[model samples]
Target: MWKALRITTLLFVLLGVALSAWRNERNATDWIGPLVVAVYPINADGSELAERYLQALAVERFEPVSAFIAAQGMRWQLPRTVPVDFRLAPRVNALPPPLPRDGNVLSVINWSLRLRWWAWRHDTYAGHWKQVRLFLLYHDPARSPQLAHSTGLQKGLLGVVNLFASPDMNAQNNVVLAHELLHTVGATDKYDPSSGQPLHPDGYAEPAREPRYPQRYAEIMAGRVPVGPDEAEQAASLQQTVIGAKTAREIGWLR
Candidate 1:
């Protein structure tokens, strides 16, 4: 009976979150003030480098996210700044299990349950249940050379950013972080999942620009600079990226 009740409660919570996310997506012009996002660090590899990287992290490192949103909001003539206040929270010892690559519904639900269990065990949502939360799993390149893929869920106010623990990777890390941040706020990925390339027009920053072979900046959702018809490169930094019209619309920065 207890197990059944727990499953029922989880389903209710998921339903509520799904409804909330749907409403938030449709109400594009509603600005409910600055959204607070808490970022929790996790030493995925249990390496000294990962520990040191976590120790050195500061809220200032994510300030660019706020700046980027403010800039885009200004362009859309938003009533006020769509500010995102980022807070660096305490670290978690264990990482959540990997998400299913197949992305089936049952697999996604199981993944969410496992992730929720980990978050509850670590008190990740204890004080900030109302605010958005992000779990950043940092992997030390020296220990694990393979890059860790990231994920974010719109229904839950949570995300997992898998990144390397290095100062040189900070810029790129922010780009990935920002992209996942938008994902939590109902922004969909604009890139081609198969090729990992930005789709034409919607993913292109300057879609209307003449001679569009070479793009000066990347669409934040796309996360790549299109150099040609069949080739592209990752934006070195967030400075070279912009929230495009479609993305701005999706995220409620534009009407």
Candidate 2:
């Protein structure tokens, strides 16, 4: 009898969590109001430099992301002027669960559940109703020049972004964060996984531009500027990127 009761209670809790997540996901791309994104900075490297960077962190540091979203929303002629409101959450003391290494489906699902539960425990932002939670794991650029891949789950409305903890990297970091933030709201990558090349037409910022060998701006979801047929370069900042029409529709900025 005791074992059966415990199992029933667990199932009930899981059901409630699932329903809440579903509701959040449904409203994420509605474009009715500015969605609040609480950015939780974590010291991934555990270095003195990373720690110091966190101490001086401010909401202004992430303004580029919010600004970009607003600008895109205006371009799409969406109802809301400011599409996203970014808030800086208190620094998280603990690291999140490590992602699966083998890329197995079952393993990935397990990690997703673990990460959502972990996020619930650490969220401390209170200014607004946080529609999305983004955990920015900061590392010392000198120690780990190349960071691990970031992840964003739409169902859970959460993202885990790897970033370099340096003032110089802020622009690049905002571009990365913006990409992952859109992922939490049902945006898909427009780049070819193997080649890392932005697909033509859909992935392009100006597919119809005359002499399109060199693109002036990158489609935000595509994530890189297509300079030539065989070459692409990462956008230095969100300023050099635009939300393509496909991405706009994916995020419900357009019908």
Candidate 3:
């Protein structure tokens, strides 16, 4: 009888451990598929800003910026693995990238419309994604009139400031990077261009400046109320609702 009892207890312990592992793995898988940031070829010689911009893209892949945005009850369509690549070509079409075998491919193109269209044609075939979101930034600042008019041209397509000519690399990179990615899964920019007021109802004024609970940084998107570091901790607090199964489905993170 004692031996049988011992065997049963051991079996229970093993089962508990297996259950725990399954739960943890399932939770981790709830996020959107990995984010793949593909950089266009740098045409201008010695474009330091472009170089740094690509680095910033790499940084954003793993770094947690805003828990609320990350957890906004949208199952992030993050990939099982997020990959960012910087290609050295003169044009977007010339870069040889493997088309996404499955799922969405968020393409952030900073190149000519002709080249951008070419990429669009090749990237989107049948059975790619539930949707395909392609965004283009005006590659040239001198042509703002044409570019500005082109902002909302295509459906499922968005155009913003093409920062290739912006003197301030950091600001341009931060805004463009954050904005384009947000649009991929139906997120709207909180900041309005006219009054600079946050469009969303959230109280965050300046995410870069504020780091409050539920929010961090003054930038509103990921600010700490006290304005300090602890981004991972802040993001973790949001996970109860951020990376769950229901949230993932809402944001198309899971099919």
lDDT of each: 0.81, 0.91, 0.36
Model 1 segments more than 4 A misplaced? 1-29, 125-130
Which residues of candidate 3, in runs, are more than 4 Å off? 1-32, 41-90, 93-119, 122-161, 165-168, 203-255
TM-score of 2: 0.93
Query: Given candidate 1, what's the lDDT at residue 73?
Result: 70
TM-score of each: 0.86, 0.93, 0.36
Best by lDDT: 2
Query: How much is 161 displaced in model 2, in angstroms?
Result: 0.5
Residues 1-255 of candidate 2: C-alpha lDDT, one tens digit per residue = 999999999999989988887888888877777898899999998998899999999999988898999898889898787888888998898989999999999999999989988998988777658899999999999999999999989978999999999999999998999999999998999999999999998889999998998999999889999999979999999999999999998888888
Please provide, for model 1 over 1-255, each residue's C-alpha lDDT reduced to its tens digit, 9 standing for 90 to 100: 999999999999999977876664444235566777888888888889988988998889888878887787787776677567787877877778798999899998999878867765775534543356789889888776777678877655568889889988888888999998888777888899899889989999999889988989999899999999878899988889988888888777666
lDDT-based ranking = 2, 1, 3
Which has the higher TM-score value, candidate number 2 or candidate number 3?
A: 2
Model 3: per-residue Cα lDDT over 1-255, one tens digit each: 999999999999989967764553343334444433332332232345444444344323324323334433333445433322211212333332322333343432323344435556544223332222333332333433232211221223322324354433334333444444444433333444454443333324332333333433333232112222222221122222122233234335557
**Residue 88 displacement in candidate 3 (angstroms):** 8.2
Clashes of each: 0, 0, 34
Candidate 3: lDDT of 210?
30
**TM-score-best of 1 and 3:** 1
At residue 133, candidate 3 shows an lDDT of: 30
